[model samples]
Target: MASPAAPQPGATDPTLIRNFCIIAHIDHGKSTLADRMLQHTGVVDDRAMRAQYLDRMDIERERGITIKSQAVRVPFTKQNGDDAGTTYILNLIDTPGHVDFTYEVSRSLAACEGAILLVDAAQGIEAQTLANLYLALEADLHVIPVLNKIDLPSAQPDKFAEELAHLVGCEPEDVLRVSAKTGEGVEAVLDAVVEQVDPPVGVADTSARAMIFDSVYDTYRGVVTYVRVVDGHLSHRDKIKMMSTGAVHEMLEVGVISPEPKKADRIGVGEVGYLITGVKEVRQSRVGDTVTSANKPATDPLGGYRHPNPMVFAGLYPMDGDDYPTLREALDKLQLNDAALQYEPETSGALGFGFRCGFLGLLHMEIVRERLEREFNLDLISTTPNVVYRVDMEDGSEHVVTNPSEYPTGKIAAVHEPVVRATVLTPTDYIGPVMDLCQTRRGTLLGMDYLSSDRVEIRYTLPLAEIVFDFFDALKSRTKGYASLDYEATGEQSADLVKVDILLQGDPVDAFSAIVHRDNAYSYGVALAQKLKELIPRQQFEVPIQAAIGARVIARETIRAIRKDVLAKCYGGDISRKRKLLEKQKEGKKRMKMVGRVEVPQEAFVAALSTGDSGGEKAKK
Candidate 1:
């Protein structure tokens, strides 16, 4: 990564300034409000500014969730004044509402001076809404509470406004009621933004200083750093330096994020712009770093821009070895945008060379897997997702084991695993069922509270390893998908845990293994063995499925030897059909990783399959 030249300072225009972000839950209409704001300001035509205009990614638009934080400058005018007097440059940032991307949302909020805290009229204030609202308040940003989705049939604006007032410690009249969908009261929200949200305070410093909020990599152009001018201006053709790494490079280009790149003469203080330097990779331009001129540097570097480390691990193998290079390239490209993702080469005796990938959470893992298959057009065989666990050694050493096959057998002293503080919001009617479900998953009930007349918030301390896979699905299934779950890492604690390793042909299948509590080891092993039996095809010889505790095999099963396979003589033009069938079976066999003669499907060992103990090892004669 090359360092860029410092930027020339530009004049500050306080009148043409506004900085704010829309903060809300997963589906509180934040993106929709962004679209309305763009349309109302005439920055984008009404027809062009469709719903969720800020969610440019295909995954976000399809899932109806904002994953990435986006910024767009819109021109808005006050209702009471003439066009000239009311004109303002509103820099609007659309942030992710999911808890997994809370770090991203926090970074987005730090770049802005004010936030529109959106709450759903029907749902009132959700757990995520409160979480993000507190973040904005902590940043000391002026928070403008807004009640959105008033057009819904279940709209309860009055009730939500009361809740909002109580939450924000303000009067009911202080909450702005608006329908981002129907465009009702939207103009009033805009008016409040300009009147309430303070303009950026100008700084007189001319030293090359800017804060990098977000960065992305382009194929043709190098690294593009999205920066908020904190104290000075930055222009192209000036030498710049990164305060943290001290790397320097020449500025290739600088521009704003319009439909197309609109080259800015210079981005002044409080303005947001992109710098296209020769730094071809995004890893060089980290988020939350200060950019300064090589000549005049800042005394203190900007901080709080660390990317989250992935707690979950999974195996990603290409269906064919031929696509190995392609898969590697795709992952590299994805990592350039998402710095949170981590991966390394891993090989199993059963499965060939593959990468063991890590993710921030389950959703992050799902998104990455989906992108590999959809965007890269590659076929993948993915293993079960597992949480990294701490294995205590007898020699007074500790190791974090992500893949269960790596866990030592005799060297264990005491093991500890990651736990999460989980909060589940559900209707009162479903509380009993939810509690039962949690207890079965070894959840320790911490506390409970009545959130409203019909809803209740239940808090529990659960092992992160247990909920890594199907807890969300199970909760939704029991609650009819009405429960909202939020969780954060509580800490690691000691537990009677052991790694259960599955072996095929005397070789451990890394993908089919997991860490389990000693109390539940037998049941977990039995369940996994049964899944593997169903997943693996019968071969020439019976294949043993064993789950071992140290040197002892606690549970076992066998995939029966294939007695019959190919059809005998096919006559009357049936030969081609039989040949095609054989070819298809061979292709299927190709997809499955073979340990000796037995073939295993990747889904058999998936984390979701470990939901219960009923589907355990099956014995075949």
Candidate 2:
């Protein structure tokens, strides 16, 4: 017997469309699961399918990480039910698993009615697993707990299923077990999604309204926005207005990405798709903006997303000063794609013209810098990352400092630093080292719990500045790559902090300055001074590198001058003649030291600031 025809790419019926996203910890096989769904739904054929098909960037593919959220539409036909012949269009948004990209996950969750909480059967529940689960729950998304990687020899499906069930408050049988790698039981996951998750509800007769979940800048097509139709219908050639910005433009095209972009006549209520308005400026088409008909707009816009708070700040400067404008333009384009990235123009004495950019975390900053270098072909240098601090001066004045250079010298009152509530999950054996690592970073223990006999969860409140450095790298190394961490900013507290400045040849270089806790200040200064002594080249005259707080020097290193042997030409000369030659050389050296200026090479700054050992990691020693 012949089979029935599959559902079309665009399903106008609200009941027939199911919008959902996959959330998981890093390397838990989210993209792999997405690839399987696209394959099983027949949206992608065998010859064209590949691993991590949803991750579009070359960097993402190379690093085996998902930095951006990708939305795709797939059609699935029911196999065994009273309505077995019926088909449904499933909109799957694949999100990044890293803690830095939580903003992306939150945005994706807002558009979906359900989320697939994916966990590795071998690793079980991780820090990000709990973090993302809380986010999904807060969004009121119907979460389907699924244990992946069951095909692996290390798979412990039964044990993890109970843990997952306990976490989600569901029975073990309700927790679906699937191997996203081998495509086993993937159909059951899709079936469970359709049966358990609620379909989107929107009014078809009302004025057009859609939520702009995400957007990207295309070099040829300008801005391509991904939207979820919440009410009414949006068709081609309809003039649209942005409810937040009050900007209007004609919709040039409307389409759905069924593994690829295919043109459609209209995107109706409860559908997820892309829209093209030919808007060139990235800032104009903001993420979380409401899109509505220009002639007949909705009464009120949908509740837009909260602006992301950047916890880490760093300065990005072009190696070639002429590329400053190019860097600005690149950041603008990148900001459209990554709304969480924030930047503003700032001039540095050492690095020249650049922008002090804010990111959610270190990974986000690294990805942004890499994207600028690769995509825009601009060589950039980033200063050491720091957290924002609120400084109260003696004269009853306040200053917010992001860079160490901005820290006030006359701070006579209190300095408040940002703190985070950190959560860590690890095996029972590594609990001691984990706690020790957190304590060394000046963390206060909040709580601890045993997930099972073998796994445990630990919580702590740590300063943001501490974790922004090498905390994650340290945690992973200490635990032998078995621990996972997730943290949330928990307001600020007044702390005894001091700004340590690096001075070369009696002149302070603002790029190497850092704000550190009072206790770590001396070590930080010593480490920075030692690092500079190695990185800076020898000059004609001796150069002194000093780390100081205000006028008091805490650490110092001398870069010895390259001395030319003035007596090298003297062979069996008289004592007075040899003495005269040495005196002449000494006088010349003194004059050179008085008149000459030591030039700190650009590579030295980059090397000293970029290395992990140059920061708090070495201060720990």
Candidate 3:
């Protein structure tokens, strides 16, 4: 990368202000680079600087991933020029790279005029790098390709630069190389931002047209919406209206984030900042809504504004009935910060009252679950996560099924499940294991290409169900942590799928039911029965643990009745004494004849999802 001289900061004009985001795959040093930039700008002191400075949550730091999009404003001084002392307000929005948060990335990119396309020097480009690079290009933003982690022992900056140039249509030699860990060549990054990337640009309208990219709730001030002003200016004294929701409120504060919420009297066009709208519900102050003055509103909302929809489905049930309201409160609060989550009231005979929740993907669901338990102090259990499937009955009517319990009671129909297109980048040695894992999930190979002598990229079309359960962990294990994958929706497909139900003591256990292909139903049923046998404890009388599809039993297991110890009449080992002891034992067995309902443990549900092999390998959350 060229260490160009920093351009002179022009007048206090919005055109000189650069608003951009650092986009990359997971663990590619996006947050670390953000911290370094903050440190260089002096917004954060050397002693205050820590790993993932912009990551605000404990879960994010613990998991080493960014869950939410965060933005910060920095002051940068120019090198040698007529306007050297003038400081430019640099707005940087840090986005998550996980496939689950792709929608978040798109919204973040839509708010920026340029992006630093960061890649790990050693790992090269993974699946998400290609996914997000296309998104950035689709937005028609300036992409400055850069490589990080250049100080590692196995650093291969030249090779990754060549691959990135070939794949993303950039010059290999021009790709910047720097070690974010050591702060080497860090100033060049700032120089490139000032010289190469363009300032934020927008509409010609005089009316205020701010695009609301993200929003969250504040306990004292209500909802604070993060936005990038496209035209005109926004002020705390003005009455603002959301074009999408038509909710108007008085703006209480307008400010930029210097890693914290700092107030300003007003924010101008081509600048990124936040506004506090005294709206109670966070949904009303939505992401992608247009924020404008009520008296002088914009004619239209900005392009690419959309509501987040549910992609993955699960059931969240509270352990105690008293916690039902608490659970709803937790979800409502969580929804204030996360627009991607969707939930509705649902009831279960086995587990009592709960909610049916929807998320963007598996990781999104896991994060929500963790937050509920850790943040809210609630005891909850989530059922097996499933994808939305379209069930076409023999009558030609179709409906979507989110839960196994919601499947049709009687049907002669076809089921179409959600399918995903996955891009897997792995080393050459683990090709067989990766292929076998995908094949077992009923995936169809799309294409393959060797990026270098040691690395290859393979694409496949697989069912979303297969990918949701332990596929990522399996891929990492098989490849010794060398494989990284990302997936996108490719519509749905018809499959010979059926619902498998588990019965305890001749009664159906609704939560333990699952949807599987007809060909694998018997095998899956056997696995479920065996797993239940081990998980469910013995009762006074015999308990029949059965796996059935409707009324037909495919597999069964019997927990033998507890035998009584009788030895009072076995004295002297005589035949009459032995007969007396047997008679007493028979009497004791008659007393335990009334069979009680068997109690199934929570582990049974988890163990039932371990259907791939008979060895009972549990699925990951």
Candidate 4:
């Protein structure tokens, strides 16, 4: 017996079409599943399809994570003869699995009507899985759970399915067990997707209404807004007005997100398309906004169009001063694609020229920092991440401070700091260690429960300021890197924390500083002063390092003076190299922010001061 005929193209039947996003915890086979889907759809021939076909960036491929959400249209043929083998457009959006980019995942889900929740058979559901599942449900998308990586030796599909049913409130039969690696049960998932997910609701209308889901900057073409036509049909050369800005521009190109960019003269309702207007920047083409005809307007704009705000901040500086312009250009290019990233030119007396960059979270900061170094081939010196704090002055004034240097002192006032609702999933055996680690980081346990026989989920209300720098690393270390953590910003609360400034020489290093707990101030200051002593090169005079608690010295160190004079002796023969070296040293000295006559290294501005020693001293006191 021969296999059934594949579904044909242009199947208008709703049962044939499927629009879904594949969401998973990091390394749980999302991209691999996407590859299989593309291959099964025959979009790319077997020879052409690569591992992570959707991840175009080297960093994404190397890191084994999808940093950005990508959309691809695949045409699949149903095996059933109900519609005599019809072709359907399977619009698949692959979203980032990391918690830091959960906001991006949420936005991408708004464009889709269904989600394929992928879980590793061995690991079952993780903290991020629960988080993304909740987001999908909140968006009202039909969730189809899939057990991925069943080919692994430790696969436990049945247990995972049971957990999925219990955790997500889904039926056990509804969870499709599949190995994306071996192509087993993948067709069942596709079939379930077509059966469960609804198609575009209404017919295409010529009326002006389009929802911009995402936008990207094209060097030659300009800003290309990726939009889904909800209530109208848009065509090339059509003049459209941005509902948010009221700016009108003629469409230069209309295309779908596919290989070679399939050009469409027009896109109908429920179809996703990319519109290239002459607009040079993507900031104006805000995500979640509406695009309408200049003359004909829609009744109302789409909901959920709030702008993303950055919660964490750090200073980004070039290792070499000459690379400052290159770093700035790279940042501009990066911001063209990411609307949430914010930055401003900041000069640190010790670090020279740098930018104070804002990110959604710590993961977002790491991705950006990695991308800068890998994509732009530039070495960067990054400061510790800090949370923005809200301060209420006694004069009835409110101020937002990102760096510790800007924090108010000697003022009678109230201060508010950000906090997060954090969730951690780890092995049951590691709970004790994890709890101990959380307490040290100022995390308050709100709740805990057994997620499974061996795994437990712990909930904590943590100060965002505490976890902004190294909480994730600490948690991973404590749990032996088996814990999966997710967090969302809850709100601001009153706190007695103050910015403890680390002064190198006599001037303050803005980037190496942070807003710290007043109780732990002296220790943090001392550690930082010690770190600077190790990082900065010795000069002619001994440089004094001090951590001051509001002008009172609490922790102090000193860099011993240099005694070598080899350059001074080589006055004639090695004069050129010596002069060049001296000039380079002078340039380096210029880069260091001078406190009085002492020069401090840029690294001193961002290194965390060790508080352990200071804490011990305090205990003795």
Candidate 5:
């Protein structure tokens, strides 16, 4: 999205430019640290600022977390330091700290030359800190250790910094201490960034080339892509073509964020900015794709671009059947901003038409669903979140299953479920309970180590399905909120799985079909039958809800028939007459519905699969 022309007061010089991103564990104050740096550089007015100012979405602020990476250009004028008399163009990328958005960190790091590794002094080194530090190293970015929250009552910067230094292979004195809340020592972070973080260097070329790190869609202005110019320059006159998709468009505007999009004459080499292509289709300007001048195209696309792989799948159906077109439009617009989100139209016999969407993780799935309902104002019903399963059939072929209906029938070979390597950081006191919980979920202990005197790091290999539901919540509850987890899919392994079907009355309902482990099938089926019984209202006839595997029924429950007011019309005529009429009505009920279809409420279907707070609801019965 572009507005009237306005550029920040500064000279875009490559030699004085620093492109870097801030990385931290959740709740460790990365965004607050970013706000302090912005104030120090005079990019954001302190009086007009809000807390966690970098988070743009309402959900982000409400949750007190950064869900997306925000970019801004800061002009740091060093007056009394080693770099005095120099005004550097610092491009700061505020990255999300949660494990679900690790790919976001990777994308931001691809466009940066260095990173600020922020850690909490009170909490010390946690799970995400180690995970993110390794990601930065993998990207070969320079890392400057910054210890934050030194002002907290429990702050112990010396100890945490020492531990951090040991992990990064540096001296303890190299770590910088800062208090983001009080804006203390934040300037030191800026100075250290300029002095320690090297300036960005671009390929020597006159042909225009830029990398699209992220993008967002605007209804009025079309797709606005965020890009970092790697070589040459991008201006209003250039004809741009995406290297990956090959869709060409004329550049309408080029500008810098300065937090908000501001127009500029041009974005030159080694400069971070935005590109307004007026390209409505988001697929044309995908993240990690190279945007090059169509007339003078670059011989090769930019390196280090990997296609995003979504880890979770769920079916999102509109509450009303006629809203299918509206849902499609909303998804099209939503996917423009989120390149990692994948969606395709799917049909379910019970739920009708909907889309089977893929997400990076559970949080990603939640955010997408919330946005669809709140932002797009569409009522949606989501199925149970499932990991992609691999089915090895007896025909000597392998197939992937995204929906329960896709599960192969009469399989003779084997079924393989996804598995993940989970890392848990918790206090030493809670180690026993944590390990016990993991083992019960069919987890295999990989290793464990003490990070500090009272904190321990535990690693385990768990079935991806086990953790996809409420594993994080259970871990936190067991550790009394002292635990943080980070996980990555390792691969797939042999699993004994069966498709449990839910039959209403006598007919099977496809919406309640789930592929569960064989050992848990009976209990799971019983739970499903009980839950469905509660959700389905009593009709004229007793509705039999049964959970079955193959041809045999495993568990069954029934909703008792509602006693109609047949005696109301009797008017006290005769005791024998009333008895005969009641008997006739009871016999009529048996033949009236003849195992007809049963209707279930949306809430019942959701509560049956929802995790976290309502996990105990299904097992209650």
Candidate 6:
């Protein structure tokens, strides 16, 4: 077993520092490659090593995906080349590959000088691979294309290498091929990183200025902010000010993660490390905020990241009313780490206290809810997810509705819903099925192109609401899991959308309300009404579940009443006696039906809101 090397003298020298991130499609061997790099650099010993070494969260480990962008300072000593025997500080950020975590990828790109565009040798280039490459190009980072999984029997490294080279505008021989599984040619990756990636440039003598790329809340240490020192240096015990919030805190600890936290006296220019300020409040340490010395602040804070626009919105209510405050606190902590999460206090008539939270997508919403339950230990019920909509009033005012209950009541001129331009890469045989799926979801064909002889790229403009749920699942099923999709918001368009409200026993259940397109309203109502009937328990009297739009009822289902055995006493008596007992029972049942309220249980809401039904019928009002 071996220990990681300590920071050598001149380790923070701008010329010796290389900041780069691995960007690729999901499961394209980014994390595995990162592990090999760590092993090759001797940052982790055999005893401390595990798969997906950069992913720390239990949920991430269980799902085998990179949800967060993890940074590690690997000290790679060049073995062969003109720079042989030279140790370079490599700040490697492992970014998420899912479309939902695009913001994480963007943030990581901003801090890096170059990116390793990884592609699966067997799977070739997928939709997310192109998406990430464009993002890196937009960030103006130097890109080194690499192909992983070359050892697999199905891998066509030569074919994919040509594809990668063509995509990157490089020669076919320029693409690096490696098997991350067997750790072959991984050293080549490190050597190429040092030779190709541009060194970070910054002035070390100026006032301290660092960009907070990420942050997390720890119960013991409070907020731990991860920053990339852009200019000057940050020293331990220095009072640092958050340039955005104008709040100041003393840096209790400054350290670098050499796959493990190692204390550092100062993080100089071109270095990446974490800073603990012991500030309990999460809002004070925002991602993208600039950290500067309080006494001699930099004249200008670096350009910060754009706020992520939440594409999906949902309501999260604690199952127990008493857990509301705990849920709020938990969300605050999560928001500090996931800058894309947005939430506000909201109250539902049926579900009681909760927050109206916005997420980047359906997966993002699911992950946030899981974190609330697993990490915070709170029982939560999340309403069906929906996209934000804008309602134009006849009075010339407009309102934005994230929740169904917030839909305008007055005369509405029109409702504009968010739209996304989706790109799908699939085999030529699956193009017809893919097109059919998109068309059924109210998609308009944008264009199509032949990426290769057998690979085709299809583009469509679709309503965000249509693809938020089940779309990906349906696509995978239709394509036999051979298609990859990526989408981005493409503004909004006025549409014939109506709010569908679900009423139980003539009272509206705010938790089950959703806004749907006019053409699909009847079907959505019918399906939701049917789903509620199966979920809601039978009451003393018959309960009628109705789905309505405004004052018009579109669909209804009835839950039969629990019969009382009033006739049991007269079982052996005369016919008149039995008739009288039945009549009395009917009268009593009618009276109870008139006065009784349907006490829908919390479990009913949770079950109905869950994605158990067709995505089209999700309660997304």
Q: Give lDDT per model, in order.
A: 0.77, 0.90, 0.81, 0.77, 0.84, 0.90
- Quote the positional error of residue 461 for candidate 3 in Å: 1.2
Stretches off by above 4 angstroms in model 6 are 1-6, 9-11, 80-84, 612-621
lDDT of 5: 0.84
Cα lDDT tens digits, model 6, 260-308, are 8878888988899999989998899989999999999998999999999
Backbone clashes per model, in order? 14, 0, 0, 12, 0, 3
| Per-residue lDDT of model 3, residues 128-160, tens digit only | 898999999998988889999999999999899
lDDT of each residue in 1-621, candidate 4, tens digit only: 112333322223434556789998888889899988877767777888799999988877866778888888776666665565655677889998877788778878888889999999988888889999999999899999889988899998888899998877878877889988988988888888777888866445456687887787777887878887776677789899888888899988887775447777777666766888978755678777899887687767777555677888888888899999998888877876666788999887666898999998766777788789987899887777788888988888888888776777667488888888999999998999989988987788999999778999999988887876667777777887788888888988888876776666766666666778888887888777777788888886557787776787778898876644547756567558887877776665456435337655545443442122221111111
Error of 1 at 21 (Å): 1.1
In candidate 4, position 288 carries an lDDT of 78
Return the lDDT, model 2, position 38.
Answer: 87
- With a 3 Å backbone cut-off (N, CA, C), the pairs that clash in candidate 3 are none
Better of 1 and 5 by TM-score: 5
* Residue 361 in candidate 4, Cα distance off native in Å: 1.6
Candidate 5 deviant stretches above 4 angstroms: 1-11, 80-84, 571-575, 606-621
* TM-score to true structure, per model: 0.87, 0.96, 0.91, 0.88, 0.95, 0.97
Model 3 lDDT, residue 173, Cα: 85
Model 6 TM-score, all chains together: 0.97
Tens-place lDDT digits, model 1, residues 1-621 = 111211222443654577999998777888888887777766677556567887778877777777788988666665455443445677889998777678778888888999999998987776678788888988999999999988899999887788789878899999998988878898888788888888887564667678888887677887778888877677778778898788987777877764335687678878877888877655678777899877676777656565776777888888777888898888877876666789998886666878999987777777777778898899777777788788888898888787877887676788888898988888899999999989988899999988667878899999988787667777877888677777888788888987788877556766677788899999988987887777777776567889887677988898866544665555567577888877876666545435454556655544433333211100000
TM-score-better candidate, 4 vs 5: 5
